[model samples]
Target: MTHPAVADLIARSNRLGADARNTNYAGGNTSAKATDTDPVTGQDVELLWVKGSGGDLGTLKEAGLAVLRLDRVRALTDVYPGVDREDEMVAAFDYCLHGKGGAAPSIDTAMHGLVDAPHVDHLHPDSGIALATAAEGEALTAECFGDRVVWVPWRRPGFQLGLDIAEIKEQHPQAIGCVLGGHGITAWGDTSEECENNSLEIIRTAEEFIAARTAGEHPFGPVRPGFAALPETERRARAAHLAPVIRGLASTDAPQVGHFTDADVVLDFTAREKLPALAELGTSCPDHFLRTKVKPMVVDLPADAPVEDVVTRLRELHETYRADYAAYYERHATADSPAMRGADPAIVLVPGVGMFSFGKNKQTARVAAEFYINAINVMRGAEAISTYAPIDESEKFRIEYWALEEAKLQRMPKPKALATRVGLVTGGASGIGKAIAERLAAEGACVVVADLNLDAAQEVADGLGGPDVAVAVRADVTDEDDVAALVDAAALAFGGVDLVVNNAGLSISKPLLETTTKDWDLQHDVMARGSFLVAREAARVMVAQDMGGNVVYISSKNSLFAGPNNLAYGSAKADQAHQVRLLAAELGANGIRVNGINPDAVVRGSGIFAGGWGAQRAATYGVPESELGAFYAQRTLLKKEVLPEHVAAAVVALTGPDLTQTTGLHIPVDSGVAAAFLR
Candidate 1:
């Protein structure tokens, strides 16, 4: 059970975090002072409950807070060294734990614990940051809030800054908060309610002051003629084409997932003539630039440019950005500095399209894009009221490569095998397709679930992990246009195509003489032609990405075995079986591995079995409908009934790291049917 004061602090944090205008995702912290019994001494002890390191205030819980003895926390003030060694104080905070160390304390813990108030709120809201980044920020802060909110000059966050703020708090008895110059805002009160109100007052007042003064000023200037966002369809089409190429470049050092945004603020900024100069100045807030990078690589071209020409230029731009970033690292890096993580830019801005942000996974990439937007809001506000002035480049370098920041990165959990992979699974709404989608998602790959049933696909995607791990797209595999669109949707949804599963198929059980032309065409077009179209379209994206990919075809045992009453389906399966070998030999130069799975009569929970094929097969085999699975199992040496999960497991193995050196291989998940084994 949570203490009432702690619960109140959490409620206030969530209220502020939920509103983007109040703060960005994971960009703020809050704290409350409370009393709790000391378990060891059996006496009451004043404790500080502050949001811990790497926690987002919006979703914070009791476990996400650090509980410390207020007396011990304040005692650190006596031993506080200078600002140069302030990072050591963070390590020293472990000794101040009240009981079991709840969570690792953030640097902001000092600011909260050292303050005289019982409640504190520190935020990076755009409105406050705008005022913080303005050239005349200190004076403007005074004009906006008078003595109620004071201004503190830019000082790197550490124990010394905490002391500085504490001194300011002591000096200004009437002040409710202080705006952090070139950073954000901090507020304090005797109660959680008062603290929250003070924080809100700072944000709202800053917003109003900026709004009144910059009412008619066009900070970003007018939109350039050809730089405005293209029509919806045109922009999406362009994005789909360029995303794979951009993702490939961004993943030069490590694989990354991507997120795209065309919000009005982004468009209004990207389309402006002054975008280059403003973007070159970089972001003002540390949280904003930490994810978005020091600056974005601006795509210098018309939105209406030819696709081939645009792709060529994008490659050139990526190369230049990498070189410039490398130079920047060389210019400021000390011997003790952590190695540069990557030279690739996290954010990519195209004049008429929008922004593309990349990270090791989907959520990270989305947050990066959102943070860049916050930076944009800060810039717009600052340029309108005063010249935008962020911290110096050297300061950004110090924070970016700080040993503590590197340690935080190192603390992240090891990625799963399929992390950063985008897999497109056809017929994914049910049966084997759904199983494969879910399995890939479990292994950390982003799955695009495609089926004729949009609602069913969405349900499967939602089950997998919603938009972050999976997305749903309605597609008819037999149609070339739909197959192309499906591949495009995957690239647009999660950067590029890293894996493709040709699982959308059907069967018609009939004697050779009784099989109609339509039956043959349906099976052949869907199983054979559909696989070809999907592979062909996805191959284009893979080659653009320059990243090796996997393509697994769900071939059948009937392809090699002579089964009576099966004509069209068997022939189509044979066509698919051969496709694996042919495509493997052709695509090997491009690092794409083509493989197939042969599963005999997967009747348990199979869509084909439920769609009347089971009855037809049972009648042909002279067995009861319910006994068909057993009959097929009995024919195998192991006598095991192959389920959808078995086939999905096979798909994961072929696409996983273990099978990197194996291609054009067909694995049979048919409970050991020696007759259909690959030679």
Candidate 2:
């Protein structure tokens, strides 16, 4: 006979699921265990009634509950060969249900059975998930709960996970519930009301913690209000794609996880070029790890991107995720080690778009989805506190390759593009400029090489290998007309300019007292004034184009410190440093990004050193040309002379999509010069 509380429990479980569905496509799941002893048998029997598959909790019925005997499931562990046979597992599970062969048990029956409590309810609440994404998520949880919770690192769900939990219960008999890493939470008690209360408390605690932490901080800062919301059709499509995953991971009688779009925040953060750092923050909890992974795949969609394109892009990300997972595994795996299984994420968060979570049931999926939202907040918070530093590549590999960790990878769709769009360079002629120009072109952006030397620019353009791939332009950046011409040339050639590098400058050696006005003017003309000119012209084009742009100014260590006899060059470069900040503010309204690159003494044979400065400067320093190079090299933290190529890479980073919203930033390409200043 059915227990009296079973019906009430199912109703409450369905309500929780509905709540989840309305909130974030969370795929939340709930279950109620029958605690009443059989009057005739006079024996205790565990019966868990979990939500059925493919049903939404908001509109659930009695038929949705798949009833199963908990003890029977626990005993079947010894009978199965390895628990990989889903068909057999399903058959055996169906045998113990109330109907005896009607509907299949929820995929998370095993997971629910692991909890010793009579009733267990799990959900991927948005607040709870966000707190779990940090590198110190466990600490965050502790701070939120103060020893009322048990934390489990991410582990693949199903038999292995269930078995592990069962063992944990044996060790810690009084443990209440668990929060799974990269996944979601599990709350249990003797009654459905008790479980629900516990789950609610967890959500409330997490919400309060996040609110306290972000009390006075603005995620996107002061910006325009009343932005257009995402289209309804597009939102539904995204929701549909994520629903299944969320449902699959959840443990409810009906999938009730809600899904909402925070397009404004997502877009603003992405526009700021902070996605990579945000993604590195990982999920809110280990349970989320199974859905979203440690990091979410970021994509910048055009305002006009079609629904089909968005979906296609998502599929592409999944494919890339698989490849990345495989590569990561290969990098750290030992010969005798077990290989990683699955290569898909439990959750996929598209900034400025939406998020997707996958699971065998609604609760798990909702948990994953909620975790994704939490991740965004935590990432934003961590960024505010200090730059978020996720585990390094090696550590990521360790987690991705760990047998337990690998099990979280799921089946996913394909990836979209391998390269970004648009590029710019200041001194794109020889040495570093030429190398950077070539690198970006290879990655597939129509390149514009701006240089004071027209002939050198032409040569670099010629060597770039395609007629439409690169264009050489002449500009005395200090001259407004020339700077305007360079911008116009790039726009005419490639539709519009998206990147600019203020790289044309000369370094001269002269003691402060001995420096003449003529020497200062010459240095200031190209290094300081030229940078402003180029930035102004580029900003105009970028703003008009409406696609945003990047401006990277190549400054030098002389800007940071006074090298003996280099007074004029140093002063001019220092002016360029200040220029980056001014331009950042000026063009910020137009979505134009600006930054500066400061490189220490780079080796000769490059454009910056090509005009006989290498030999002359070397001799004046009282050392041979080759020995002078070594002398400068030995002075750095790395004891390696900064190369033109190193500076070129920095230029690419500043201009690339990888750093879309980053502006007014200064990156020291010196091995450690500025660092020494701090020391």
Candidate 3:
């Protein structure tokens, strides 16, 4: 049975972790003290439960709580002789575990053990950090919380820090919490509820103080939509021109595949009249160094800058930032420190264009972007109130190089199956295309969602990990220029496209005798020509990169087995299947594989079924439109209707390594269609 206090602590910690404003994805800690029966002593003893390091608080459970005997933890402060005890403390946290079921205790376990209250909570809320790391933070904290909060000077967190906290508690016996200057805040109470409330109260106080102090200032103005140097109509085009350069630079020396995330805020901030002065202010918090790094790399590129100029400037800026970072490390490292990590910048800010955040994979890049966004807000607030003051280079170095902090980075999970690959799916605004895009992203591939409906495509892209993993592009596949641009966009968005899914089509299910030339032309133009255009353009890029690629076409079972009124649709689909085979034959030597998926039914959520043809077919079958899906399911040998996800899975498989030796093939994704089976 779980201890009631530990259970409540997990629930409360989850609530706090769920909100990024209160704590970042895997940052912050919480603890509770409870009495448990000692197995050997047969007596009730004080037990402390603290959140383990690197465990996400939002999904925390009883098993995620590190439990330790209070006496064992308390003894460390007494026996420890000096301050350099990080390695010993880590070992002790694991050795002193009361039970074997939990994770390693957080590095701040000793500090939490010193708090007299039964429940203690530590949070790195942005609002609290904004005030805590300010130049006049000490005075501002005193003004806001008065005697309710005490101030702790910046100290390297470990044994000596815990001792200092214990001494502070003794001096201010009635204090509810204390602010760790240049760090975060800690709150304590007799119960979980009290501790949670105290922490929130401290945050609320900070929020109100910040608002009141900066009421008249407006730091983040709306980003102007167009570039200053380019004509209004060509503003976006110019920005697009720089995308590939930024994406290329980001991928250099990346251990895994790297990509870029774009935003208007980044461009707006970089275009400020005083870019150098504002950007050089350094990170907002010490922990932020892991994401935004010491500072962002700023490049000067006019709105109308040519691609060559943009590339040159970006390369120069990256080199300068790296050189500066190495110097910073040399000035700060001591004899005892580990060698400083890489000097590559995570964020690159381009004037007139937007900001680009880079990572070995999408998620890390997104997190870096999020941190800088918050940093912008906090920096603005600090400057408005007073001067924006954060820890000096020496302090940041200690925290960044700290063994305990470095361990958390080492514990991050390995990348996913398709970690650095990029996938592009046409007609991805809805139906099977959307499913394929989502699935590809889930497998760690950066996806490009191209559709005729630009707005719908953007919406889908925003939902699929935003601009980091997916980008929205409008392409009328039948138009040669549009098709060519779409392929280029995929390369610019995520460095290159390795998976191409040509799935865009319109259905016209009229019988041969009744189908007019107009209807027939539309179906063939979209299904046949569209597929050809996308494939040829995509193949050009793939051949240039010399990297093997996968191309899958979404054909239909109608192509092989004729239906009553599927003449136009089936004929066009048949053309697509043949094109896939030919493309595979021509491109095989270039390390490119092409395949097709033929699916039947799938009446739900598909555009073809939602249109008038499905209603006509349903009426002919003497059934309601909704019943068609069930009818198809029963008609199949497996008694299962093929879903869009089923087709999407096949696409993923074709692009995966399992089919490296196989190509020019057609996979059937329908439940089972005997008539369509290849003999």
Candidate 4:
């Protein structure tokens, strides 16, 4: 059973968190005071239910709430330490738990517990933060709300800050909320509805204040000449080209997944002249700063610059960024400080192309980009009213390296086998390609599902969990330009291509005398040339990334078996098989492994079998079309069927860590087809 007050609190939190205008992801906490019968005491006690640490309020559930005895929480004042030791209080919160096995309490718990109200909300709404981070934020706060929302001085979030806000609230009995300098805002009320409305009032008022002050002023000054966003085709073309290079630079320390967005907010900001100056000052809100890092690297080159020139400049800029980051770490770090993480910029802004953000995985990368956009909004608002002044760099370093933040990072689950790897699978919409996409995604590799059928590819990508895990790309592997763009899309969607599955193929069966040039060319172009094209483009990305990669070709047993009336398909398969060995030998020096999977017969869920080839093969073997699979299975020594999943398993094995030292080898997924064995 749920308490009505807690239910109302959860509902309130969802409403606030759901709107990006109100709060960023997991950037706020809400709480309600409720009376519950303590199991042991059999008497009513006040329980405080607050959104727990790391839980996003938008998707919050009862399980995600930290329930604490309000009395016990308030009793903490007896053992309260000074501001210098406030970090220790976070651990102390564990003792105030209402019972065992609930979401762990968060740092903001103190803020909610100490406030003398049944409902409390602490949020980092961009609008509220815009006023909070302004140079004259206190004056602006008074001017905006006329004491309805008072101003609190800058104080890092902790037990002492909670006490500070409480005292201010007590002194100003009529105040409903207050804006924290260089931080965000807090609001409270006697009821959930009152609290929710108060929070909105503060947010909306701050926004209107900034808007009235600027009154349609250009946020980033006039756009520089030729710096506005490029045409849709050109912007994306540039993004695809530059994404791999940026991803490689961002992965200097550890492999990272990348996300590229040309959202109007990013383009509008990056296209303006103030981009460099504002980006250098970095983000204001702690959540925004934490995800996007201290600052972003702004590419000063024109978006229309020569591809080579852009690439060259990005490399140079990345090197400088790394050195500067290292220096920043050295200047602020103390003996007790955590070791420097990485010197790579999490966010990169290209003029016209938009923003590129990176993280150890896809969701993190995407959220980082979103956070920067929020930061940009905050900057625009703050600049409209007054100077945009965020916390000092030293403060950012403290928050970034805080012991509490480090602990949270340490608690994250271990990455799956293909953790930061990105895989591009041709023919990914159906058959073995679809199975391969699902399996690879399950193992933690972000997937690019490419196929000629755009709709089917999208279905598979959606089933694999949307853009966070998989994205669909329509491509013709036989076309060089399409193959190149497909590989680039993988880089743009993720960080780079770490695993390449050349599974797009077709088959044709005909007697040597009856086979036309059309049949031979079609089979060879799709099977042999397509494999070569996809592998070559993937290899280029892998080489630039400097990360060793794996390439698996889904060849066929027909490559080695001499079957009657199978000349064209057999020859194309042979060409694909040989290409695998050749690529293995060439790409080996670059740490790129090439391998092949040879399946004897995978009739079920096979695109080739579904497309007239199955009937032709059945007729050739004098078997009914319905029993074609059984007939092919019977000829194998093991007398078992080889399925699409079987071939998919082989693909996973080839790219998995177990086969790191094994390449240029074709693993047979056939049921003991002795005739198709590698000679």
Candidate 5:
């Protein structure tokens, strides 16, 4: 059985974490003290449950909370007399864990323990950080909460921080909370509800203050729009010229890089007239240092910059950002500090074009992007009234190099089999294409869901993994322009395309004598011509990237078999098969492999079956449609119905590390079809 107070605390923490506006990603911490009898000694013990490092509070579970013996943690007070206490304090935190092999308590555990309350909420709400990082932060705190809140100067979080918080609490017993300069704000109470309410009240107070200060002000004033206003065709053309170059320069030593264009608050913030000064004001909160560095690197690319010169200009800007970061680190890091890590920019601000976020992989890049968006809004509010005054350079360095964060970095899981790889799946709204998208994403591939139905594609992308792992793009295979933009969208969103699944198709069943030219061309246009356009565009990107890639086409067993009333479908599929082989021959020199899958009897949940074709085929066989799948399953040697997942599995096998040397072959995913077997 769980304690009522602890359960309520967990619920409250989740509520706060669920909103990015309140707590961006995993940047906040919460703690609760509960008394429980130890199962081993049958003695009552005070246990502190705090959000562990790297644990996301939004989806936090009981197991995710770290348990610490309060008395043991309290014993460390005043024990470290030397200047270097971060490493020793971390060791003490480890020794204080009540049970063996649980997650280490958050680095702020000592500070939480020092607060004189059963429930403590420390949050990095943008509103709170906005006010905390402002120039007149202390004066504003006094005005907003009066004597209810105490303002503490910025100290690198460790033993010294805990001691300072304890002294403030002792002196100001009537205050509901205290503000950590350049960090965030913390509120405490006797109950979980009280703690939550206090935090919200404080945030509301800060919001009201900013509102009064910047009554008619805007942070980033208006500026000219660049590629932002271009037509879809031109926008994609610009992205193709810019994204690959940025990815190449960002890669450093890695073979590939991940990137995504963020239109969400990018143009509104980055294109502003005050961007240069506004951007240099520093981070809203020091904790954001983990995801978004101290500040984003701002690159100026005029909207009219020639496509040919964009790459060279981008390269120079990247090097300049790296040099600035190195110098900043050298200026702040002390003699005892660990070796400075690589100075890669986490977020890049383009004045004319929208911002581009980068990471070792797409998911990480998206996380960084989320924080930057939050920062933009927060800083805008702060600058509206008071100039943005964030923590000093020394404080940012301390937080970035804190031992707790370093340990979390070391604990990150090794990349999955398909890490840093990107896959584009056409017709991804349902059936085989959807299955392929899900499978690839599960294996750690960033996916783009392309379909004729824009709404359906968006739904599928959202269900897969939101905009991070998968993005939706509307494309019509027969249109040359749509195909070109589709390829460019994937490349722009995830660095470069590594695997292209040309799986869009529709069947038109008609006898050769009855088939009209329209019917014949529709099937051929979708399967044969669509596959060709996608394959050609993907190969161009893969060749330009100088990295090996896979292009898999979904054909049909009808290509090899003679079937009644399947003239147009069968002929188009046959064309696709030959097209795949030709593509393989041409792209082989560029280290790109092209292959095909011939699937049969995949009736259940298939688009063709759902669109009235299954009943027609069943009526032709003199059986009910419900029995069509089973009847076909019984015809194969294995007596198993071909499933969409099975087809997806075959696609994975070909594109993964196992089939690097084999290409230009059509693998059958159907249970053996005697009529379709090669003669």
Candidate 6:
């Protein structure tokens, strides 16, 4: 008889899968096993139940389950051959399973069988997954789990995976499970309930550890909304195209699929110009490979590309990917290593379109897709801790080509949007903020320049006239109410906000000895606290919109290097810079990008340099106001005063499509001022 708790286990696993789907783009996966003695054969047998392709677990049904003969799977490990024979092995296994009235086995069946337990389950829980993808992930894992768990370095999944796990099991027979490096976890138990409980326990433990170590960590900044809403027909078409691909990759049967029309996280993350570094680290779980490939296939269809051309382009992409895979393998393969598998991509992420995953059955595909989606969120979280450092390129190539890892690739539907998309900037009034806003608009974005100084913002906006346009708004970034209203206005004015330039700030240059408490409060309120308020509102809107976005802070070079006379200004800017780093980590998962721009000696109409040096004071420096510009220029390698336009260019570059994978970075626009100090 089926275990009484099997239903509950399935139900919970499905729910987790669904959560992943809603949160990220094809980001997570789930599986369960049943060990029992066959009544007819009177032999010990294990029935592995994994989620089918194309559907999430939250609403998964029986049709989503892919049943594998565990004993037969275990037998394959003993007679393993090189990677070239993986297809033959899979076909043989499929034939055997078919004879028994079972559907196709999960792509990860071999790895799952290696656990040597009655039931095993895996997932890329957001918190832990994020932690695993960081630069110091291994160290962090050790600090979190201590000796309770064994950390396995990243390895490709499939037959080789089976061998690796078999080896691991031999070394740590009592090990509750393993955390795949640059990936997620695998937990096993004597029963399905035990498996679920153990998975939960492991995740909870990891979460506590991360929270304690990185307290107050958040994403770098706010994301702007782009386009109020996508047409329903477009949304449905995208979903339908994605569903089949996910189902096929996971190797599941019939699967249930769902889509989020107004997902905040999706919009917020997508509106950004780039992906956070954490997302590049690796898949949330090694098992996720069976659904979403290690990396997504980025396609940016042009506006004029016909529908047929788009489809043809997708096919070309698939072909190109295969060729690339072969080349990568040829360049990196060692004599002793097995050849990589050539089929499938676990997940396919198409900007503007959506994401997709494939499986043998709906449940498995859905679970795998969800795992990919959750990884996006987790990667965002990790960005808050530090930039994610996945194994190096050579290592990624090794894993991607590993016969074990290659097994996870699957065919998927195309996503909307191109690999690169347009980005917009706000608060392009004047000063540092205005410069950044202008720079982004100068790039490919259709910029909406908003500021309290409508005329000033409009002037800059008018200068950037094109199909990719720039417009102005009279926004007061310091007012939360105004900030919220600004978001709405931008949504209505521009299709939506893709990039947010939180460059608006105010400062009173005064020594701490003479500064009033009110002055200090004002500094904080405008630069630090005001930035927080704007970011919060932006996040709320961006997350709901389902488009990735970018956020940048126009902090001062004073944030890092303090000049004696500017106490209130320096302190406030310092806080603003810190806040950007924190926000980058928190919002990365939502696919929102955040960063800071620290500029020095930016000469603009705002007049930070109005005090003409008296002839005596000028003689003290041995230079007149007329020569100050030349004097400062002579001090730098670039030999130019920091121009508002130059600083603006840097801001635009940071917020533009070129830097999509960077977040929480502090770029100095000081013409080598900080570098000079180091020298």
Best by TM-score: 1
TM-score of each: 0.99, 0.42, 0.74, 0.97, 0.85, 0.42
C-alpha positional error of residue 364 in candidate 1 after TM-score superposition, expressed in Å: 0.6
List lDDT for all candidates, in order: 0.92, 0.62, 0.78, 0.91, 0.79, 0.58
On lDDT, the leading prediction is 1
Superposition TM-score, candidate 3 onto the true structure:
0.74
Error of 3 at 67 (Å): 2.6
- Model 2 agreement with the true structure over 1-679: per-residue lDDT tens digits: 5467667776676667666422234255667766555445877766777766544556666676777776787777777667455335545776666535224565567767666777776666665555444557677777677666667666544666666666655566565566665456777777777777777777777667766767574643432332223465554444443332322222122222222334454545544454555564555333335456656555556434665675566556656866776776687778855656555555455543455454432234445556566556546654443334343455445444544333323322221111324455777887767777887776555578888778888888888754356778887777888776676565434434567777777776767788889989998998788888877766655654455567887887777876678888888888998898898888888777888888887775475565766776787688887676688877788788887878877877777558877889888887887442522
Residue 597 deviation, candidate 2, in Å? 65
Residue runs of model 1 more than 4 Å from their true location after superposition:
none
Ranked by lDDT, the better of candidates 2 and 6 is 2
lDDT of 1 by residue, 539-655 (tens): 999999998999999999988988898989999999999999999999999999999999898887778888999999999989999999999999999998998999999999999
Clashes of each: 0, 77, 0, 0, 0, 112
* C-alpha-based local distance difference test score of model 5: 0.79
What is the TM-score of candidate 5? 0.85
RMSD to true structure for each model, in Å: 1.1, 23.1, 6.2, 1.7, 4.1, 24.3
Candidate 6 per-residue C-alpha lDDT over 225-285 given as tens digits, one digit per residue, 9 for 90 to 100? 3322245456434443333233222222221122122244543444344443333345545
Q: Which of 2 and 3 is the better model by lDDT?
A: 3
Candidate 3: pairs in clash: none
Please, what are the lDDT tens digits per residue for candidate 4 over residues 1-679? 8889978988999999999989999898999998999999899999999999999988899899999999999999999978888899999899999987279998889999998988999999988999999999999999999979999988878899889989988999899999998889999999999999999999999988888887675867888887789998899888887887888899989989999999999999988878889999998778887899999998998867888988899999999999999998998998888888899999999998889999988999999999999999999998898889999999999888888988998999999888889999999999899999999999899999999999999999999999999999999988999998898788778867899998998888899999999999998999999998988889888988877899999988989989999999999999999998999999999999999988987899988899999999999999998999999889998899888888888888888878899889998888998888877
Candidate 5 C-alpha lDDT tens digits along 348-407: 776545666777677677777777887887787768757788877777877787666677
Question: Between the candidate structures 1 and 6, which one is better when assessed by TM-score?
Answer: 1
